[model samples]
Target: MSEETFQRYSAYYDLLYRDKDYETEADSVARALRAANPNTHSVLEFGSGTGRHGRLLAEHGFDVFGIERSQTMVTTARSFTDDSAVGRESGIFDCVQGDIQTTTLNRPFHAVLALFHVVSYQTTDADVDRTFANAARHLSADGIFFFDVWHGPAVLHERPAVREKRVEDATTLLTRLAEPRLDVDRHTVTVRYSITAQSKIDNQITEFQEEHCMRYFFPEEITSFARKTGFNVERSEEFLTAQPPSDRTWGVAYLLRKRT
Candidate 1:
């Protein structure tokens, strides 16, 4: 994985995910937060790429602080925040580039968020452990942690397949092909993405390759890590819905609270 993944795609990120409904996701996250602690107004988001979800949360009245590892992503997120009414104030939507696994801001928030498989992006045991520790450190006394990741049972049942996506606009045309290589022994999948972008007017083309290594997780694995990281698992359910996870569930969201 060249660290340049987000750097390469930050500009067209919103266009790439034009169909994504961040408002619904943020609402779901808010529901979970309210269920755990009704008065969550501040949030710290891990791996907050492009700050899409963070902005939505901020619009919904949460003071959002996002941590991203990519400088380009941070810049893009900051630009978006600067342009939005909900984020015109610096305190409403602030983003920083830092290692999510071990960053300590000397502060705690009403909640901690690892949306969009930020947890699965930590493919190593050490990475996962440190990320959970970071979340624990950033959470208030009664704060809750919310995260979603690829479900191990679903991954095992329906193995990953090669996929391609294309999004085009008046300015440019973008294509992405994802080829997955699964390591069952390590319980990880490395997806090699070939991205091609072409300018509409000049007919100029640019191509780049990036490998994203992600790990799928089981409920037990989450619980075990939670125990070691001073967190308590409150709920594990299929993401984007309240249904309990099953073998067919592709993604699972876990809600956790700091161990008191």
Candidate 2:
């Protein structure tokens, strides 16, 4: 997705995904991180939307730093603080605005994460390779690089389709229509989102459209990319579950370790 798309999408991101179980997902991530590296302490998260996962990971005893491409999202994420009893004045989690493919911190982390199909957003070969390289660059030796992506076999088997969702909060009603156009050769599905939001107080309606091109990946390609980027593919399984990838699984997670 482009920065412009993110700018418009950030406003309603939390509202749109309010029903998503971020806690459970973060728990799954924490479990994976711990199982992969028992001593895992610091994490660098790519595409950390609103710092929800980051905050939960911090609660799991990890110092989390998030890199988000959208400045609006970074600002919104920074607004949230740690109100816990062990409150540190430094805040809960930190987020910076930067692209995953090129951003560099010149620092190493115990774990690197790019959740929520952030890899799939890299629609091109160069983008995907550079993203992998970036992850490897920031990771400590023997550290884990965990990420989820659109499974190519499943994407091809089930195919993309049009879908609509209606969600409302106390003050507003939001309806979103997703229309997908698939390109087999590119292994991409361009989903165009048409959202209509209505304010309950004045009954005012606002509509907007955004396009997101998602790339699906086969395990062989992922392994190849990992090898080229100085990583060994440690595990490949369904996200939040240890099931092997198959035509039935759309979200597949891969755990990779930087070569020592």
Candidate 3:
């Protein structure tokens, strides 16, 4: 993916998902961490866009490290952490720019996370395998892994719909439209975003487009991958809740543990 893919989205990312409850999501993560390992003290997050989750995790007393591929996102995430009191003295959240499939830190983490469809971004077999390998390598023997991805069955059953969203602030008015194209054979969906922004202050308008390719996943496939990578599937369920994954659940979270 081109670095500029998120260049424009990074500017309006906060406004676009202004309603997203990062704190709630972080709470869910914390609960999972506790259930998996009561002594959880460190976390490694991939595709930590905007770093909100990492920031919240840090606030909850976990030392958090994030890896993002987008330079613009890395810059913004760093600014958020660097400007915080925890960042200045506690050294809680530290974000770096790197591809999750290949990037590895010198030390291991107690918990590894790939939230918000970060795993789906791996559009090929090699990409998927390499990502799993990295996850296993970076995790301690007792480490747990958490990831959320689009459910293939649900996506095929419900199908994605066209969406339009408009958000505004004192200085800018923004409109976004999404057009989705599905490749049933490849189990991939390409969502094209058309964004229009008008600055109320200067009356200037800017428009841009971005296309994101997401690969939907199935449970059996995950089980196979986990076994191949020397890990066991501990649990799989709907994200942010205890509901079991079914044909109706579009997003599924999988909890994994290293095999003893």
Candidate 4:
């Protein structure tokens, strides 16, 4: 992954996704974890972003640690924690800046999570393999690994299209345009993002561009990764809804249990 990925984007990340239902998603994750192992207590999250999910998971009564690739995101998460009363009181959530493929916390957790299509961000085989291995390393025996990814069937059937979103805060108006190019053979979609931000106070405008490549996965391929990493495939379902994945399902969640 590029070092510059999400560097500038992290500043506006929360604003772009402010409407997302983090609570519901976290609830689903908690249910999945408990169903896999009722004793689950500690959680290590990869691609933790600004720690929204981590905070919710912590509130669910689990000790949550997060690893994010962007230093800006890590700082933002920590700042939020320091400012929030609940965060200071509970103190069950913390995060650091690190890559999922290379960073080793040297401690095991009862569960590991890579939500919000974080695993799909690994666009290459080696990257995916290393990420899975890292997850395995951070998990206790029979620990659960749960993640969501773009489903191959859905990606292929529906196809990606250009889209735009506009959002604003008191200080700034932000517009983002996304154009996608699908590589059928590679099973990847490269999304080019163009963002324009205008200051509400001074009307000053700034623009930036970034490209992200995401991989969609098949069930068999995910099972293959689990098998190679000493895990047993527990289940797969549509994210949040827990419905069986089909061509209509865009995001699918998978549960894997690390073998003893």
Candidate 5:
């Protein structure tokens, strides 16, 4: 959560996630939330980077408020929304700058969401538990919480040790490299990023680095944690499916309801 990291990558995030289809993912998450608690109207989105998912939820008729850790990301998100006609027309989006573990809002929401592996960014059990507790604090009675994270089994199996890629547009070029570190006892994976970008005309290259650590929990462990946090531990499934999670699943998505 460094300003330098976000400042370096703000312009590239949208391009990197262009194929992610957050709108569809948000719809899927919203559907699950609605099924668990049909009366949801207000939503608080944690780690809402660049507001991609938040915008989608707002357009779908939820009053969406976003919390982001990076001011640069929030600034870029604000500009992106400002430039969009749909965003201007909807007017249901609000962005706040804060960390997921410590941020406070004035009012509770009917649903809370942290999508696109944001939950994985918590590298330790304490961090993860604190984030869940914070989410619970922001939930109204009978509110539901939804989030997705990288499945442990998938990470251990894939064991992505190295990757390199480049992206270019008319005006700029971006180069990215990823190195993975595994902490088996903790079931956590940390990816160190090295990014270099250059302007097409000036050819001025800037380099930056960031580390993203994601803790992978067993499905039962997640359920137990949710229960301890006063959630009803509704169910969890492989991403985008109703099927039970398996070793082959790359991610797990959860639906937890506030104990009424």
Candidate 6:
């Protein structure tokens, strides 16, 4: 709901997600949304960081509106579609700045999505419920809502306590250190990131720290919550396929339809 950490990552978000197959993921979700209804035309994308998925949706001929909490991310997202000279024009991309838990739009959408583990950012049940309620308020009757979250079994089994990686480009060297803390009873994991970037200009190492807390709900718990929030639970799958989640699965995607 806040902006400082997201703002700091805005400059490097694309670089970090460059390796991720966002286009493939968008295609998969779009196919699922379309199969749910032939008339699906407009989509609302929450936590649409840098408009990566939004652009893909536009390319698929769907009207896409993105909501993000960070002003810096919204600015970068706007540039993706607004800069005609840059030749990255997807006129269907529109971005707004607001938190998913409390934002409202003028009209309802045919479909809604929150990809890239955005749902995990909600560390409390109240936050999750508020987000689902807000999304339901903006969804047309029979519209589908799709989202993904970190898999509880995977986190509990793997217990990835620490990680370190570095990315170097022509102008910058970015180093990242991650420390994970697990709370078994809460089914929550808090990751602390210590990031250091050395600018090519003077090779100065600038340091920044960010803490992200993610709640890992069981598959049944999530589906039950969706049903309680007035959604007809459609399907929950491991990753991109319709399969039971396992201890090694990193995340699971859920598809829910607004009760008609």
For model 3, how does the per-residue alpha-carbon lDDT over 149-205 read when each residue is reduced to its tens digit? 999999999999999999998999999999999999888999999999999999999
Tens-digit lDDT track of model 5 for 92-171: 76788888899999899999999888888776778888889999999999888898888877777777579997888888
TM-score of 4: 0.97
Which model is ahead, 4 or 5, in terms of TM-score? 4
- Residue 150 lDDT, candidate 5, scale 0-100: 84
Candidate that scores best on lDDT? 4
By TM-score: ranked, best first? 4, 2, 3, 1, 6, 5
Question: What TM-score would every model get versus the actual structure?
Answer: 0.95, 0.96, 0.95, 0.97, 0.91, 0.93
**All candidates in order of lDDT, best leading:** 4, 2, 3, 1, 6, 5
Q: Write candidate 6's Cα lDDT for 1-260 as tens digits.
A: 33465667667777655678987888898898889888998999999989988888887778889899888889888987754223343438788998999998989999989998898888788899988988899999898899999988888877767989788778888888989988888878888888888999898888888877778878877877797788977887886776788888888898889997
Candidate 4: worst-modelled 10 consecutive residues by lDDT:
82-91
Q: Summarize candidate 2's per-residue lDDT along 204-256 as a digit string, tens digits.
A: 99999999989999999999999999999999999987899999899999999
Among these predictions, the greatest TM-score belongs to: 4
Candidate 2's TM-score? 0.96
Q: For residues 153-187, what per-residue lDDT tens digits would candidate 1 score against the true structure?
A: 99999999999999998989999999999999878
Query: What's the C-alpha lDDT at position 150 in model 2?
Result: 99
Off-target runs (Cα >4 Å) in candidate 6 are 1-3, 83-91
> CA lDDT of 177 in candidate 4?
99
Hey, what RMSD does candidate 5 come out at? 2.2
**lDDT tens per residue, model 4, 162-201:** 9999999999899999999999999999999999999999
* Model 1 worst lDDT window (10 residues): 82-91
Candidate 5: the clashing residue pairs are none
What candidate 3 gets wrong by more than 4 Å, as runs, is: 1-3, 83-91
Residue 213's C-alpha lDDT in candidate 4? 89
